[model samples]
Target: MPYHEMDALHYVGPGWAVDDGFAAKVAAIVSSPGWVFDSFGYPQVRELLWEHADTVVWLDYSRSVIMPRVLRRSLRRTLLREPVFGGNRETLAGWFRRDHPAWWAWSQHAARRAAIHRLVHDPRFAHLRVIRFGAPEEADTWLYDLIHR
Candidate 1:
C-alpha cells in the first residue's frame, strides 16, 4: 500500500505503550489529506480504525497457517538480526523467554481469532466493508481485483 502511495502509515501493536504513541502519531498525520493508516493487530483499536477505514481486508487464516509463518519469520529475523519496529530486533532468546509478542499471540490465537470474527460480524462494523480471505491465493486475487478496479 505504501508503495502505491506516499501516505503516512501507522502500525499498531497490542502493547498500549506502543500503540498509544502510534495512535497519537496517526492522529497527527490524519490531520492532513491523502494519508493512510495501515495497522496490524490490536483488536482493542478495531472500532477506532473501522470508523475511519472504508475497507478492511482480513486474512482469516488458520492457526496452523499463521503459527508456522510467524515462527519462520521470527526465526529468520532472530538469526539475521533484522531490524523490526523502532530499531528493535527479534532474538531466539526473546521467543523462548515467553514474554515476546509472538509468544503471546500464539498462545491467544484461538481467542483472538474468535474476537475478530465477532467484531467483524457485529452490527457495529456494518459500515465497514470486510473482505475475508481463507487462502493465500484467494487473498492475492482479491487484492489484485481491488487494486486493478
Candidate 2:
C-alpha cells in the first residue's frame, strides 16, 4: 500500500514525527507475517518492524540524484496544492520553511544515508536481508527482477 494510504488509515500526518499512536498501529500491522512496511527512517518504529521483517530495501541514492527529485516533487506539490498524507497539503509559503521537504532532503541526506549504512551493518539487524540501491535505475532493475522472479 502507499505511504499516504497507511498514514490516512493510521491518522498520522506527514512530518518529522508520526502521530501518538502511529508506531503502535504500525507495530500491530507489521507484526503479522507477510506484511511490507515502508518508512522514511522512522527510528521510533524501526526496531519493531525490523523484528518482523525478512528484507529491508534502502534507496540509498546520492544527494545529487535525490535533491532534484525532491525539489521537483515539492515544487509540483506546492504549485498544484496537492493533498498529501493525512489530508495535509503543501503550500508555496511552506516551501520556504525550514521543515520543507527540499530543505530537509538537502540538509539531512548525507546523515540519513550514513545512518542507514550503519543500520545495515549493525550486528543486531544482520538477520535481515538488506538491499541498498544507489540510483533510480538500480531500484527499477531490482523491482523488475523481484516481479519477474
Candidate 3:
C-alpha cells in the first residue's frame, strides 16, 4: 500500500527500488562487496550508510543556507515539472500541505540539526571522517582537496 501523497513503485529507477518492508535486500545492497549505493532516506537505510561510509560529507550550513536551496529546488521542480524519484514532483501545494512530511521537516530545521550533531558525536561513527562545511566556498574547497587527494 502506498500513500497517495507519495509516489508509487512504478517510478523506480536503476539502483533505486521501493523497500516497503523487506530489510534483507536493503542490507545486501549496502554491505555487498565492491558495491556503492546512494539516495537513502529511510532511517534504517541511513543508519547502514552512516556505519559503512568511510567518509561522510555533511553540508553543515545553517538553515539560512539550506532553506534557500530547498526553496529553489521546489521552485525549479514546480516550474519544469521535473520528475523526482517515484514519479514525485514538487509543488507549492505539497510544500504547503500540513500533512506532507516535507512541510514538517522544513519547519523542524532545529531538530534536524540537533540530530545531525548527535550523529557526529556518536561513538559508532567516531571512525568515520565527518567533513562539516560551513559555507558554499568551504564545501567547494573540501571537494577540490578530496579530488586531488
Candidate 4:
C-alpha cells in the first residue's frame, strides 16, 4: 500500500511508519485477512510479522546487484523530482547525505544478509514457509510460477 494511504488508514504522521507504536499498529493491521505487508526488516515488527505471517518472501539479492540498483533508483528519483511517500521528494543533495537510501542499503547489506540467513535457518521459524531468491530473475520466476499455479 502507498505510504499516504497507510498513514491515513492507521492515523500516523507522514514518514512515521517506523516510529514508536508502529509495530503495534502494524500488528493490528495485519490481523485482518487478505493483507500483504512489506518492510525493510525493522526488528521491532519482525517477530510480530513472523508469528502472524503464513509465508515469507526474502529477496536475498547480493550487494553487487543491489548497490547499482539503489544508486540508479536514487538518481532517477532525484532527477525526476518524483514525489515519494507522503509527498516528499528526493533531492540531489540528499543523495550525498548519510541517510540516503543508497548509502543505507550499502551500509546495512552485510548485517541484513546475516539476519535473514539466521532467520531462514533458525528452528524457531520452522513453522513459517520461506521463499528466498538470490537474484531478480529468480524472484520473477517464483512470482510467475506462483501466479500460474
Candidate 5:
C-alpha cells in the first residue's frame, strides 16, 4: 500500500498530518511479523516504526532524476482517473496544490534527502539495517538480487 494510505488526507481531502490515530495504526503494523512499508521517514511515526523494523531501503536519487518520474506518475494517475488511498483521484488542478505528491517531491527532494541522511546515521536507530541506493540502476540491481535470491 502507498504511504499515503496512513494519512488522514488520504481518506479526507487535500490536507495532511500524521496524527495520533495514524500513529496508532503505524504502531500496529510495525509490531506485525512480516510486512513492508514505504513511509519510514515520516517524522511522527519514524521512531516507532524504525525502532522495530529490521531493514530500511532509501533511494537517494537526485531531484533531476526523480522529478520526471514523479510528474509522469501523476500524469498517468490523472489520466487513468485511478482511485488512490481512499478513492481520491489526482487531477490537473490538484497538481497545482502544494501537498500534491508530484509537487511535494520536487519541492522537498533536497530537504527530505538531507533528513533521511541524518536519520540513517542517528545512533538511536543504528540497530536497523539500512540500504541506500544513489542511482536507479543500483536499486534495480538490489531488487533483482533480492527477488532472485
Candidate 6:
C-alpha cells in the first residue's frame, strides 16, 4: 500500500478489504520471477513473500547509526515538501508521531532486529539464503561485488 493510503488507513482504521486486496497483489508479485522489494514487511503479506523468496538481505545496523539516518531523511523530506509514497509529503508534526519512520526506527530498532534474527534462524525459512550486513560499508561492498560480478 502507498504511504498516503496507509496514513488514511491509520485514521479510518481497517476492515475495508484493503488488506485482502494487498495480499492478492503480493501473491501476484511473488508468483513472478526476478522481483525485488525494499521491504515486504506487513504481516498480511510477509508469509507469502518470505515463503517464495530465495534470498534475504538483512541490514542489521545499530540504533546510533539508524536513528541519525532516519532523522536526517525525514527532516530533508519534510523540509523540502517532497512527495513520498503515493504523493504523500512528510510533515514536521508527523515527525513527532509514534508511527513516523524516524520515531518508529528508533523505538522498534531492538525489537525489529530481534524479530528478524528469529526469522533468519526459524526452521520454516531455512531454505532461504540470508546475507546479513552489519554496516553500510558491508552492504555497499556486497552490492558493488554483485554488480561487478
**For each candidate, what TM-score against the reference?**
0.75, 0.85, 0.73, 0.82, 0.84, 0.84
Q: Write the per-residue lDDT of candidate 6 for residues 1-149, one digit (tens) a residue.
A: 22213333222322222333566666777788766666637766666767988998898889888888988999999999976654477898887788799878888888888878888889999999999999999999999999999
Full-model lDDT for every candidate: 0.64, 0.75, 0.63, 0.73, 0.76, 0.74
**Mind giving the per-residue lDDT tens digits that candidate 1 earns over 1-149?**
22211112232332212534655554444444443444443454456666666677777788778888888888889989986664567766787767575787688778867877887888877987887888888998877897999
Between candidates 1 and 6, the one scoring higher on TM-score is 6
Ranking by lDDT: 5, 2, 6, 4, 1, 3
Q: Pick the candidate with the highest lDDT.
A: 5
Give the better candidate number (1 or 2) by lDDT. 2
Off by over 4 Å in 6: 1-20
Kindly list the per-residue Cα lDDT of model 5 for residues 1-149, writing each as its tens digit: 23433444324443332244666677787777766776544677778877887788888899889899988888999999876664578888898799899879888988888888887899998898999899999999988998999
Question: Which 10 consecutive positions of candidate 5 have the poorest summed lDDT?
Answer: 9-18
The count of residue-pair clashes in candidate 6 stands at 0
**In model 2, which residue pairs have backbone atoms overlapping below 3 Å?**
none
The sequence of per-residue lDDT tens digits that candidate 3 reaches over residues 1-149 is: 11121123223553335645434555655565544443323455567767866766676677777777767777788889887865566666776777344465577778767777898899988988877878999999877997999
User: Which candidate wins on TM-score?
Assistant: 2
TM-score of model number 1: 0.75
Model 4's number of clashes is: 0
Displacement of the residue 149 alpha carbon in candidate 3, Å? 5.0
CA lDDT of 1 in candidate 2? 40
Clashes of 5: 0
**Alpha carbon lDDT at 114, candidate 5:** 84
Clashing pairs in 3: none
* Candidate 5 global lDDT: 0.76
* Tens digit per residue, CA lDDT, model 2, 77-140: 8888888776688788887888788998899888887877877788888899988888899999
Q: What lDDT is obtained when candidate 3 is compared to the true structure?
A: 0.63
